[model samples]
Target: MSNPNYDQILVHIIDYVYHTPITSPRAYQRAHIALLDSLGCAVETLAHSAEARAFIGPVVPGTTVPNGFRLPGTLFELDPVKGAFDLGALIRYLDHNDAYPGAEWGHPSDNLGAIIAVADWLSRSQAKDVTMETVLTSQIKAYEIQGIFQMKNAFNKRGLDHTILVKVASTAVIAHLMDLTEDQALSALSHAWQDGHPLRTFRQAPNAGPRKGWAAGDACTRAVHLCLMAKAGQPGAPSVLTTPRWGFYDALFGGEEFMLPRPYGSFVMEYGFFKLVAAEGHGISAIQAAVELAKKLQEAGEKVSDIEKVTIRTQKAGKTIIDKTGPLRNPADRDHCMQYMVAVTLLKGEFIEGEDYADDSPWASDARVDELREKMVVIEDEQFTKDYHDQKVRSGANAIKIELKTGSEVPEVVVEFPIGHPKHPETLGLVKEKFRVNMQKGGFESATVEKMIEMVEKDDLPIHKFINLFAKEVPLKT
Candidate 1:
């Protein structure tokens, strides 16, 4: 008989992923769109900074594995471990992938690092067809695993970064992707639980830095490593989560047990929101409110100098994650700051972009941004907080109220969901635009971009063909 002491959480996840049948056509279509969206994010991030490329590719030059995993936006074919880091970091570099908000906030698409790496590697090394259909099914499963755990667990509250879920979720799905046995899957997941969790300090004040951008990638790399070890016959930690005083729950989760709101399925990818603008997820609605207020200011023939004070009301998650004061350190710092996002939108009277947060960008050093940050006040709206946590609503609500020098207040503009939410049918066009623009930004030719759109739009494209299209390398400048 199987050991009765195996961690139930790991067992349940493995069984669901292995046993569940994806019967919903809507789920498959959503996953396909998400794959395209995430690849767009990866391509765009390639131009963010050369620093990102340092962590990708083979550990040494000219050490390529035959039929190895191909990274998107480059020609490097590497072992799955390094490939996961490359793809994961690229997808998350700009924080532009899909997000699902609840008790915890995370980019569920971050798992694409491991999902794509292992799937591509398997297709090339093994004889599996690995169609786009297979990739979509795996993507949906990974998103569900991560999103469901996020629904009820407040990892940030315990001072741990939310990417812990990335490691766990990726490990489960990647093990399945490699076709590991149930015991090997169990061992792989057990190792993920034991891996040290990253502190959220890099994501917070006075110390915020670029690590936040690549932390998910690091988690993805580790998840792949664990899966490989398990396949090599590593022993499973049967009680990793429930061990007395040392388990994940007691040690890292503040002694509270995990609360899974529902059984695992395709619900998360079905409802996940893509970012129309490349900013922190919590601050998107606030950015929208600010943009509306800016339009109103323009119509009233008002200048940004006419603004006396700015008040922002948002969900508690927003206040916890993005609220910041004092000197903004870098692009990472600026992007995560609520006041900075609002200031740029109100001052420029346009939607913010990833380049806007660059350290050398004029906006980063603009005195007016600091001026607005000083005049801003952020508070939590109890109802917005409640609605954000409500399963049915799950709205990332925020309201912006600006006061003029004339002692008159601009009408408070509130947004329950940002433009990218699935509820807004109009955003489909915008997401398509974002994909095209990002592809060009990543240095692909216009014809290549058109071909990518054509190929991805087709329902019967094979996964290996899609991967090969992305494998075409851009010529590096001498």
Candidate 2:
């Protein structure tokens, strides 16, 4: 029989998280919106054809956490691990999710990897009675864990995707949900330590496409598997991050534990941006710049030909990732290409998903777009760079100051915080809207969509029931 000793510890932690009330308002608020936004992402992404389906999808996504925590649209019940991966992937599959500028790691909503998987498995298979409170607590705990680890953790710098943090956080949260004693929690962490992180090859060029979005889901899957093993009396190695030789410090982290410029708390969730578009983070600034400039030129009734040049100054990440000057072969390239977003915005006077760049129908390479691009010089602004590094005000905001052949320079407009900024407010309303949009995109009926919004808002819903709602199996399009 499975060792009851390990099981008890796991069960206890899960119980505590499930029962604990959320006192932090920000945590509670973030939970509600993230719930909708994440669900939406899952709905929209799972709607696509490229997604893998059925057969061995998630036969028994474990059980034990709480009720109402089901994988949206799919009835293939699963362990929390599978649930986490599925839900996390669903949410992140679309590039439209919340992010933190301080997180330099793409998006923060990726935590769904651990939250969904662990919660479902514990409630379903393990016979745990998880509740809304439990989900919130665990969600917060996982967010804190991931965000804390992210303070100084530069995964991309190490050529690893930021989703590694999701794995770490999810592992910790899973252990907590399992009611693992401190020792058990630590043990689960050991497994995480033992398991190496994947290279960021999927987030970069050529291969840098949809996989970048799914990397977080993959991490959650690994987190659940490790947690389960730990709950089964598996041993873990200590000092995984600092060990000599093959240790993470050398083999992975390069002999450094992350340096925290600030404490890990609700900070990440609060400041994280909800991507209004699908392009990578670095390109946001450039896109904003292009959009701003296009607005002015268009208002003047001027064509792209009248434009003298388009110049963009951005951070190192933008330069390294999206600053392309060639044929954008696919949507993946088009998404990140600074010129593409800018060019499309200028020519069409708008940038929408279907119009600007879709896999099937692509915008032809226009000389006008190129003309603006040729004259466009992108450089790094020293002050903008400084502001970006300021811990107290960490932002992914961009400043655009453009000049025209008309001999007048457009006023430099700076956006320290984009829409959905936790500090800027209205995030809840925005997130709710986004969630509805996602559900609609997934083709969810009005009734199903309304039920989800109501359930999430009450915060008293069971994890299993939540699962059942999503269990409708968001169908894939041909």
Writing each residue's lDDT as its tens digit, candidate 2 over 36-103 gives 78667766666653543432245444443333345666655555666666677767765667666543
Which parts of model 1 are misplaced by more than 4 Å? 1-4, 457-460, 472-478
Question: Least lDDT summed over 10 consecutive residues: which range in candidate 1?
Answer: 469-478
Each prediction's RMSD to truth: 1.8, 5.0
Tell me the tens digit of each residue's lDDT in model 1 across 1-478.
2234688888898888788888877787777678888998988787765656666778998788888888988888898898898899989988888899989899999999988988888888765667667778888899999999999988999989999999999998888888788888889998998988999999998889989989989999999999999999998999999898999888887778999999988999888888988899999999999999999999999989998999999999899889999888888899999999999999989899988888888999899889988999999999999999988887888999999999998999999978898777866677878888888887878887777777765655656677887865642421
**Candidate 1, TM-score vs. the true structure?**
0.96
Which residue pairs collide in model 1, if any? 132-463
The weakest ten consecutive residues by lDDT in model 2 span 1-10
TM-score per candidate: 0.96, 0.85
